[model samples]
Target: MEDGDLLSRALDFYGLPKKFDANLVRSRFRELSRKYHPDSGEYETDILFKELVQLRDVLLSSLQNDPFAILENSKEDPEGFQFYKSAKQKAAQAIEKYFQFTDGNPVYLKKEDNPALLRLRQELETAKNGLEEFLEKFPKSIWKEDTETTLKKISVWFKD
Candidate 1:
């Protein structure tokens, strides 16, 4: 079976989100492993238990490596990295816009809430947090420099 098919099946089996969440995946794995372990006696020498072990290994290995790096290094697809690069660029643009909207100011104005500004502030925080999560997940990403630069600019906006 293809890698994508395997990944899809694994995600479905574990009830994991489509997006990779290391902590969530690990937690789920622990829970399932405890129940399905060979010594757990939950099932007696079954294919399902073996399948779970295999699935866990595959998912963990995939998460441990930089999938983008694999694509970039593949001889079959010379330009495979383009898709990921474009995605990073788009995410960066959204983050930049969020920072621009905040303009280095607090969301509150004169101790009264401006609903519109408050909404924008929330959006900005979400965008920043998303980018931060991405950075943590893909530490060796090609977009690291740009992402870090944007994060630094956003941080300056919050200075007291």
Candidate 2:
């Protein structure tokens, strides 16, 4: 699945001057770690402090490198706009039948009445309601105006 807004948003996330790609992200994180290292002698920084800070930056960059990183970045980026857009397009295709609804929807309830079904149902309801609430509370979400439309519909389908 490919998102229309992913490249733009990922670029912004890494504070890159240009568009996002695999190599630039690695370079950016490396630059950040190098500049902020405690051994740079710019300040009296502690080893633990530098390590912790740099570790987080490295991990975040690693997420970007992963093929699934775009999905991970979407949650933290904004209203999950880019992620949802790509997902919607993929879900609409007939070839995606092998992939389950990873968003944790309650579609399985129609097939069985097991305890797991109830739990998933609850989760699906929560995600849906949360999206609805988020949209109402945070109008005009960052980066996109219609961010709530798709999510709201997804959520409504889970209403119980």
Candidate 3:
């Protein structure tokens, strides 16, 4: 196959466009990896698997070197991009509130469900849910990594 054809095929395998989309690529990789991992008992040593790895590597390299490319591609899907951006902002605000409530200290011990704590928890949950919704709506969002990072921080705070 021609180089361009191979690239196109690779992108198709991951359900991505010619332009890079880190979030969608990673999400699809995770799904396929789970199914084809050596320990998954369904490993395939065919060209398809090789193509998957090549596409993943190319996308990952692009992400590391020029992450802004993903943002450029987002212009093609403005509505979804806008939703992702808005949801991410909302989540960030909620996370800030959470930190304020805890006074920047780690709540090592789980406290009783007091009214204030309950209210704070609700706010955090709302933010997390919003981010989750964005992920569902725009699996290929350029802000996916940021969203996931924020979610992880929220999870850590909840453990307090």
Candidate 4:
């Protein structure tokens, strides 16, 4: 395929705009590779492009999987808020339940001790992580303040 076609395909895989600055990609990637790569300059353009694709994948995934991004994306209307708000709330509740069930317990413990509770805790942590990330990207999201407030409750654990 042509370079443009390949670039477009890469963009599509990462859910990015097809039209990006070619020179910027060249420069940014060159800089990034220098930092990330052990033997940087020896790589080919195809390799560079592959790295670019990987970068795009990471950035896109981070944003897409981000709960804040989800909220921001859905902010065009009221109904969008309903789904995001519910998810944010659910995540908060799950985290709370997780904390309650695991109160004063060792963090390194295995899930087999209480399989159902452990599973619930895992899900709750996952939801909270997603919500936290989502809130970061969509600070002005409909349920953002509530999400932040909920996040603060969880934050206390790591402090002590």
Error of 1 at 13 (Å): 1.0
Once superposed on the true structure, which residue ranges of model 1 sit more than 4 Å away at CA?
65-160
Encode model 3's per-residue lDDT on 72-145: one tens digit a residue: 34667754665556455555666676668778665443547433556666666766776777677667767888
Q: Against the hidden true structure, what lDDT does model 4 obtain?
A: 0.55
Off by over 4 Å in 3: 1-79, 99-109, 113-115
The model with the greatest lDDT is 3
lDDT of 2 by residue, 1-160 (tens): 2343554454454577443434556786566656655776345667644554544455445443332334434335465554444444432331233224334444443424334445444444434444454455446767234445656555543444
lDDT of 1 by residue, 24-116 (tens): 677988888777777874866657777877887778777544334333333543333343443344445545665577676655542144444
RMSD in angstroms, candidate 1?
13.0
Name model 2 segments beyond 4 Å from true: 1-32, 35-107, 110-116, 138-152, 155-160
Which lDDT values do the candidates have, in the order given?
0.60, 0.46, 0.65, 0.55
The candidate that achieves the highest TM-score relative to the unseen native structure: 3
Error of 1 at 86 (Å): 19
TM-scores, each model vs. reference? 0.40, 0.30, 0.41, 0.34
At residue 54, give the lDDT of candidate 2.
47
